[model samples]
Target: MISRIVRWAAQLVILAGIAAFIGALSVAPAFTYRPADMAFIRINFTHGAPRAECWRPTQAELTKLPPSQRRPNDCPRERPAIVLRFELDGVVLLDESLPPSGLSRDSPSPIYRGFSVAPGPHRLHLAMRDNPRTKEYDYTSDFDVMLSPQQNLVIGFDPRSGGFRIR
Candidate 1:
């Protein structure tokens, strides 16, 4: 009787350990930082021009696109574009511009502002498409940003002030 009781207790311990291990493994991915999630910073363009408008893709709209079209590099060519370039620790992680319609653009927007950056102190730079007759305006700003785990950074362009803010 004593031996049987001991065996049962050992089995229960082993089963509990296995269950705990599986639980940890399942949650580990959520806790760990994914490279893709941190690859590009978000630059939100909310202020639209007099006739220009800005909108984000809904889940249904995103699903409507084919997998090939959903890629970051597969943006369609269009006008009135917005591109976001992200730098982390002074290193550029991603740099590509897209139109307000999420299409590709040959030149970046005129009012270039804001960038998403990794969690740390970083130097942010903005470049705008300019005509040869116009003066070039590239702005650089330094910020100490700290992003918590699973945090999505948002840099906004406020038309009223013609400036950017991190939210």
Candidate 2:
């Protein structure tokens, strides 16, 4: 009888250990965490523009199309590449030219990048040019920020707002 009790206790303890192991595996890590002395900035954006040269369909071409298919302008399927620039305190940190959409280059090109920096006050500058032919950027943003240790700064763009957003 005593041996049976010992056997039951041993089984209970083993079951408890298995349950604890599974529970540990199921638990998630802390929502926010960072290693010693580190901070980062993340930028995500998507934008595109049609080719600069667009024209109305020729009368013969329009006639071939169904009445519902006719449109004022018929733009080429290809789009221009996007130029992205990021600066930190007047120093250029990232300068990249991203190709437009996909095989046809008719979709929006997306941009996602991350940069690591020391935790302190700094100036940030960002610019984007969708038109490869133009020297000037279509959108620009500049700001001064104070960063804390283990902090993450996010930047994005909104076409409707016509500017970059920082958070």
TM-score per model over all chains: 0.39, 0.74
lDDT of 2: 0.85
Q: Each prediction's Cα lDDT score?
A: 0.52, 0.85
Where does candidate 1 stray beyond 4 Å?
A: 1-40, 46-84, 100-119, 128-135, 138-140
- After superposition, which runs of candidate 2 have C-alpha atoms over 4 Å from their true positions? 28-33, 55-74
lDDT by residue (tens digit), candidate 1, 1-167? 99999999999999999999999898776754455444335665532213223456666777899976554333334444434455556577556544443234333344334443345444555443222233443333345566654466666665456556666
User: What are the RMSDs of all candidates, in order?
Assistant: 13.7, 4.4
Among all candidates shown, the one with the greatest TM-score: 2
Query: In candidate 2, what are the lDDT values of residues 55-145, reduced to their tens digit?
Result: 9888899999999989879867788788889999899988998887687777788888988888999999999888777899998999899
Task: Give the clash count for each candidate.
Answer: 2, 0
> What count of clashes does model 2 give?
0
